[model samples]
Target: MTTPPSPPNPKAIIFDLLTGLLDSWTLWDASTPTGTSLEGRKWRKQYLEVTFGSTVYGPGSTYEELVARSAGESGLPNSAPEALLQNWKDLTAWPEVGRVLRALREKGYLLGVVTNCSKKLGHAAVRNAEKAAEGAGEGTWKFDAAVTAEETGWYKPAVQAYHGILPLLGEGVRPEDVLFVAGSAGDVVGATKAGFRVVWNNHVGLERKGDVLPLREGKSLDEALRDFL
Candidate 1:
């Protein structure tokens, strides 16, 4: 048996589609009224300060620490910290994500979504993606595969989470043949570690932390795909 030649075009463009928790998650909106514009980043900054006591500062912090900090401040018992995690369904897609994803799919590339969301929310995000695609003038944006944290038992920055997608691919896909797009530095590090070409979706123009090294950076998914092409 011989391995197939790597696809001249990528076999898949794997996306770490963060759940609408920042934009749509009702719990977050209720907790803070800053609106989704920069509200998510603001909450996360406060969350880090409140939870980490000045130690860890960003989303790049270890998931265990994040959960621990959030649970502590959330007034939830550490024994069952699940409830402290933010609800994701309240998030709405960014204005252009739907249209861009649909267009990418129409261009004949395989599309996959990987997220650190619970299964229920993950499914909702996919539906949101499909709807967004439709609004963008594409009828539907169906993914070839979708992996949620509930299925992977890990989160971004964990090599296991990235590796979890490998076996889900169809016959010819290789890790190197997939391009991952993520908005967070930790996610970029994890994806790069897992051997995927990574594109940082730096929509806000945040500076990269020292540890993360992405293959490319773009201000939007459209720009990211353009560079990929």
Candidate 2:
């Protein structure tokens, strides 16, 4: 078993939107029929990996379409999937997330968020983290940059998406200098392919398959780094 890597004194930390920062699974867990606790959210993640790229529809679709389809596929039809999309704005950082971010900021690491949402929704999600962080007395969640597929017209795990985000991370930040925080297997592989070091935010005990290695992994961002200290 390859252990997670220690941070190479990262210049910035770029977080994945859906699973990295917010708790999107709870929403799925609330529904998911047949057998009562089959974990429909896992299906949703796999669905995203498929739909975010070339599938039946070709290339990809918007966040709205993705959510609606995932909901419908997971037995949440007539569940107002679009309403769930808006619910992102109401999400707070997962437990200890704000504290971990504050610690990184104290060390002068710039922070960012990368998502496959529109310009409008992506920024709103950032505000969601900002609210949660500050309310936790961890200071405001300030990001040095934010990127969305809607803004760049490319979903993640694709070189184009990472390229779109790299330049926005700030003046001197290099692809090698930024630490990409991955919430899923696709994220880990994608960011690695993009030549960025990575940290796996494995909050849900998701398996780490394939050859892509991460800098670290932990239930919470804080606990992950403890190995290095």
Candidate 3:
């Protein structure tokens, strides 16, 4: 298929944190009892179901609690989530992410992250990305906005979650003016419904879940976003 052109003069670029910028699957896999990607994927799939299917996220809600619940639903032993949390700092960025983000920054695009986790885990993931970028010699890049589901009190695909990023991106930035880099299938529909053009980094090659399509789709961050950079 022919690639779609980048949006004309987007005011900002928002990203989904875990799958968009980071190789979070490996971490999830390593935390599983079998330490196999197959097992990890099974658990991760269940986790996605629980997370995306939820309707609300309040002060009492948390990413950790959801992880544990997913593990149980996956029939994974209790040790899986315990290990996952214990090694949260091990979250790593996709190899090309640092370079891709650096290029976008160089082009004067405003960058941000809107992730489906609590504020604490969301910020920690950003720190991990920074460290990974530094190691890649991309220096340090700052996000104009880093929003989380907990902060929004709603999950992705929810209009509120997508809308929440707008105010944080400062006054006058509208959803249609933003380019959202989606990490998962659900995000394409979510971001589109909220009025942002999307570019999906479909690293795992999951099936498309909705009628909406991203402006671009690729197997890596760089490939998915190179046109814009």
Query: Which candidate comes out best when scored by lDDT?
Result: 3
How well does candidate 2 match the true structure in TM-score terms? Answer: 0.84
Candidate 3 minimal-lDDT segment of 10 residues: 1-10
lDDT of each: 0.60, 0.69, 0.85
lDDT of 3 by residue, 116-146 (tens): 8988888999888767656666446577788
Encode model 1's per-residue lDDT on 86-189: one tens digit a residue.
54444566677876776677777788887765567677777767677777783445778888766776665566777677778787788878888876665666
lDDT over C-alpha atoms for residue 53 of model 1: 33
Rank order by TM-score, top first?
3, 2, 1
Candidate 1 displacement at residue 190 in angstroms: 0.8
Model 3 clashes, total count: 0
Task: Kindly report which residue stretches of model 2 are placed more than 4 angstroms away from their true locations once superposed.
Answer: 1-7, 31-39, 51-60, 138-140, 227-229
2 or 3, greater by lDDT: 3
TM-score of each: 0.72, 0.84, 0.93
